[model samples]
Target: MILHKDFASVVGVRRIGKTSLVRVSFNDLKDNIIPLSINLGRLNGKNYSVEDFSRLFLEGVTDLIKNYTFVVKLPE
Candidate 1:
């Protein structure tokens, strides 16, 4: 659904399998897609700006590109 629709949100109560589902999805798609998954609970009461989220997202993506065996080929 995420791949076809470009977006999907998984929500459920704590201690459920939401994280597990996302982890499985990422593992399956990591070679072709870079994902940014954050612990929103850590920001529940904090004053975090969109720029902060963007920074964290980019950091995660760069880390994946740097550490994983995923390949990114630029167009000629």
Candidate 2:
């Protein structure tokens, strides 16, 4: 769908195929664009601060780059 370039979030309810759609869509774009998938259902409550979220998000991105070992370069 090439959505990450245009928008940020996809709103939907549980068991309504949100995760499945995102997973498939993100996978299609991952080679060219970065993707960060968070299970917000697990982030509810006191432990879920914005700072924590930012850290987790960066960690996921770093992990992706490391795992892929891509030919396309990243900034230093």
RMSD of each: 5.9, 6.4
lDDT of 2 by residue, 1-71 (tens): 66555557876777899888888887787467666666666666566789878877787778877876767
Report the backbone clash tally of model 1: 0
Evaluate model 2: give its lDDT: 0.73
lDDT by residue (1-76, candidate 1, tens digit) is 4654477778778889898999898888746675666656545357888887777777777777677666779999
Stretches of candidate 1 off by over 4 Å are 1-5, 28-31, 69-76
Q: How does residue 17 of candidate 1 score in lDDT?
A: 89
Residue 58, model 1, lDDT = 78
TM-score of each predicted structure versus truth? 0.51, 0.53
